[model samples]
Structure formats: C-alpha cells, structure tokens
Target: MERIKLHIAYDGTNFAGYQVQHNQRTVQLVVERALSKMHRQEMKVYTSGRTDSGVHANDQVLHFNSPMTLDCSSWRNALQTLLPKDVKIMHVEKVDESFDARKSAKEKVYRYQIINQREYDVFKRLYEWHVIKPLSMERMRSAAKLIEGTHDFTAFSASKSNVKGDKKRTIKSIDIWEEGDGRIIFEVRGNGFLTHMVRIIVGTLVEIGLGKKDETCITQALETLNRQVLGLTAPSHGLCLWKVIY
Candidate 1:
C-alpha cells in the first residue's frame, strides 16, 4: 500500500466539523467517502487536527493508505470530483509510509478575524466577528506579548477539554493587525494548542482592547492558572486554521 498526503482547504460554513459523527456531514466523512468510492472498499483518512463547526481551513493536512497504485495528479482529480463544492483538494503527494499527519505536525497557525465596526457586511458575516464598540489596538497588542513562550495554558483552554498531565505549550508569536476596511486579525502560531485555546486568548484580548481588562491580566491569568479570569470563548466562525507546519 502507498501512503498519500493530502492538502485540503474548505469553507466550513455548512459542515459540522472536521471529524465524522453519526448522521452528521463532516469534512472527514466526505473525504473518506470519496476515497472509498475509488478504492471499492472502506477508506479512512487521518487529519492533523479538528476545527469546530463554522471554522474554515486554508491548509489542512491529512493522510491515507491506499492499496491501489495511482499517481498524485490522478488521486487529486478523482477526489476533487467527489468532494462537495465548498471543499477542494489543494494537492496530493506520495509520502513515507511511516508518516502520520497528526503526529508529524510541527506547528500550526490560527487566525481570528474581527470587524471593529458598527455595521456588518453580509459577505463577511460567515467569517468575521462583528464588534460594534471601538477597540484599543495598543492594549490588545500589549496583552498578546505576555502570552509568548512556553507556559501552562490551562487558563486559556476550554474547561471541558479534559487535557491531562502538564498543559504546557509553546507559543512562538502572535500578531495583531487591522485592515483598512476596519477588520482586525489576530494570528497566533504555536507548537500545540489545547481545545479552544486560541479562541479564548482572542476573546481575552478583545476584552483588553475594550478596556474591560488591562494587559497585566494576561500575566495574572498565566501565573494564577485561572480560567475564571479569562475572557469569552470567541465565536467559532471568527477563527480559521490558517496553516499547519511540518
């Protein structure tokens, strides 16, 4: 059997999420179904990670083993024909048989977009969080700088994440920038992330920008390991899995 790596991108507006669930449409289900149809048997695909419903992906990675011998171009064309219009196969290539998408991942970058305006755009509603109130970028940027480097991120993780042992993760950097159109983007890169970690961080940063909390709150939260003091878990639609590094 040959192991193939797939680079996929999808508009996650309609699907439940990345993983499969009984009777629920999912990115994995569609990808596997397409592969199975070509193989004439059940086929399974393993992804680098999961993205919640309404969250999009620009460069998600997955892997599958196929007994049938096919070139990369042929496999890409076949899968593209089967997948829904919202999802696209970016690339397909042969990889080492020992490689596993999730385990082989080195880092991932996630972006949370916010529209700091009173009015919302119909086209961007599915991809951005609309905030009517003005936000202080200086406060948000200062708070973001505090979260860099390795730390126990339990305070930023979802309460129901069930992460065991040490909850330490290394955040390489975070960049906060605003577009001319009044759209703000928070991009975070990390070696790993707990469930809802990036969203919670963004929420807290937004609160800081609103003057509800100070930049020192980030230091206090990390030092105290306090989830109670953390800000909201920003809506899933505002966030996207921007890229996965190997």
Candidate 2:
C-alpha cells in the first residue's frame, strides 16, 4: 500500500466544517469521497487541523493510505476532478509511513481580518469581519503582546474546549498590520491551538482596539482564567488557516 500525503486548500464558506457530518457537507467528506471513488473503497484521511465552519484554509495538510498503486499525477488529477469547486488539491506526495499530519506538525499560522470602516464590501464579507468603528492599533498590539510566549491560554480559548495535556503553548509570532483603507489583519503563529482559541483571542483584541480594554486588562483576563471576562467569539468566516509547517 502507498501512503500519500495531501496538501489541500479550500474555501469553507459553504461547508459545515472539516470533519464529516452525518448529512451536512464537509471538507473531509468531500476529500474522502473523491479518494474513495478512485480507490474503490473507503480512504480515511487525517488532517492537521479540523477548522470550524466558514473558516478558510490556504495550506492544510492530510494523509491517507491507499492500496492502489496509481501514479501520483493521476491520483491528484482524479481527486481534483471529483472534489467540489471550492476545494482544490494543492499537492500530493508520498511521505514516510510513520509520518502523521497532526503529530508531526510544527506550527500553524492563522489570519483574522477586520474591516474597520463605516461600510462593508460584499466581496470581503466572507474573508473579513466588518467592524464599523475606529480602532486603535497601538492598543491592540499591546494587548496581543501579552499573550505571547509559552503560557496557559485558558483565558483566551473557548471555555468548552476539553483539550488534554498542557495548555501551555508558545506563540511564535503575531503580526498586526493595516491591510488597506479599512482593513486590519492579525496574523498569529503558534505550536498548537485549542478549540476556538484564535477566534476568541481575536474578539478580545478587537475589543481592545476599540478602546474598551487596555493591555493590563489582557493580563487580568489571563489571571482570572474566566471566559466571561474576555470578549465574544468572532465570526468564523473571517478566520483562515494560513499555513501549517511540519
């Protein structure tokens, strides 16, 4: 059997999420169905991350084993033909049998975009959250800085998340920049993430940028380890899985 690794990118605007649902459409369901057609059997795949609904991915990785010995080019072409228009196969290659897409992942980068103007663009609605208010970039950056490095992110993640192991993870980097006239982007890289962590964090940062909170409040939020102390979860449509490094 040949174990192939797939690099996939998808626009998750219309799908439920990455994992397969009983009846609803999902990224994994589509990919696996495409692969299953070519293999004449089920082809279970493993992904580095299971992104939420309305989330987009620029570079997501997955792996599956196939008993068929189809050429890589044919395999990729066949899968592409079967997948929906919103999803695309970026690359397909064989990797070591022991290599796991999740465990071998080194880091993940995500970007949350906000439109900080009076009006929203129809085109960017799926990719950027529309916030019609002036935001202070300095305040947002300062608050973001406090969450860097290895620390318990219990305060920033969703209270419902039940992740095993330590919550301590390093924030390798975070870059906040004004993308354009009314757009601000927050790009964050981390070793791992808890469920809804990035969206919750982005929500808090937005509150900070809007002058509702200061840098010290970020520390206070962390110290309290209370979900209610932070901001609401941002819309999932504006979040994108930018990249994954293995």
Candidate 3:
C-alpha cells in the first residue's frame, strides 16, 4: 500500500459539511465515494481539518492509504473525473508513510469575507456576508491587531466546541483590508483554530467597526475566557480554509 496526499478544493454550498454522517450529503462522503469507485474498494480518507456547512476550502489537504498503483497524475485525473463539479482534486502525490494530513500540518490560514455596502450583489451573495451598515475599517484594523500573538482563544470559540485539550492557540497574524468596492477581507493565520474561532473573531471585529465595542473588548475577552462577551458568529458561507502549511 502507498500513502497518497491530495490537495482539494470545494464549494460547500450543497454539502452538509466536510465530515460523513448518516443520510447526509457531505464533502468527505462524496470524495470517498468517488475514490472507492475508482479503486474498486472502500477508501478511507483523512483530512487536515473539517469545514462546516457552507464553509468553502481553497486548498484543503487529505491523505489515504491506497492499494492502487496509479501514478500521482493518474490518480488526480481519475478522481477529478469521478468527483462532482463542485469538488475537485487539485493535486496528488505520494508521501512518506509516516506523514499525516492532520498531525503533520504546522499552520492553517483562513479568510472571512464581508461586503460592506448599501445593497448586496446577487452574484456574490453566496460567497460573502452582506452588511448594510457602513463599517469603520480603521477600528476594525485596530481590533484585528489586538487578536494577534499567543492567547487563550476560549472566548472566540463555539460554546459547545469539543476541544478538550487546550484553549490556547498561537495566532501568527490577523489582517483586515478593504477593497474600493466595499469588499472587506479578514485573514488569520494560526497554529490551530478552535471551532468557530475565525468566524467569532470576524464578528467581533465587525462589532468594533460598528462602534458596538472597542479594541479593549478583545483583551477583556481573552483574559476572561468568556464566550458570552463575543459578538455573533459570522455565517459559515463567508469563511474559507485558504491554505494549510506543512
């Protein structure tokens, strides 16, 4: 058997999530089904991380042990042909047996998009969050900078997240920028992320931009580890797993 790593990209609009579930369409289920058909056996695939429903991925990584001896290019082409239009295998390669898609990852980058405009565009509605009120980019940028560096991100995570081991995560950076057309992007890079962490951070920054909170709120939240102090969790559709660094 050979261990194969795949770089995948998908539009998560139709799937329940990246994980498999009974009677639910999911990205993992679809990818595994396509592989099983190509390899003529059930192929179990493991991913670096899971994306919730409506959360897209630009370059998610996954690995699986396969008995098939197809070359890397052949595997990519065959899998793409079998997969649906929304899910595509971007690259494939053989990796050392010891490499793991999840454990071997060193850092991950995520981006959340928001359109701060009077009216939302129909074409971009599915990809970005629409905010009616004008946002203060200066305040948001200030708040974003405060979230950088090592800190316990318990306040930024989902209340029911199953992360039992550690709440402390090292954030390498948090960048907020805006395009002239009112497209605002919040990008975050970190060693690891808690469930709903990026979305909550984005929402909290937006709240600061709208004058609902200030930069000091970030410090208080981190110090208290209080989930109730956080702003609303941004919608999943606005978030994307941009890259995974090994």
TM-score of each prediction:
0.97, 0.96, 0.97
Which pairs in model 1 have colliding backbones? none
Which pairs clash in the backbone of model 3? none
Against the true structure, candidate 1 reaches a TM-score of 0.97
Clashing pairs in 2: none
Which regions of candidate 3 are displaced past 4 Å?
none
Q: lDDT per model, in order?
A: 0.92, 0.88, 0.92
For lDDT, candidate 2 versus 3, the one ahead is: 3
- Give the poorly placed runs of model 2, Cα more than 4 Å off: none
Clashes of each: 0, 0, 0
Give the winner by TM-score: 3
The list of candidate 1 runs beyond 4 A from truth reads none
Per-residue lDDT of model 1, residues 200-240, tens digit only: 99999999999988878788889998998878989999999
**Tens-digit lDDT string for candidate 3 (125-194):** 8889999898998998888888999999999999889889789999999888887689999999999999
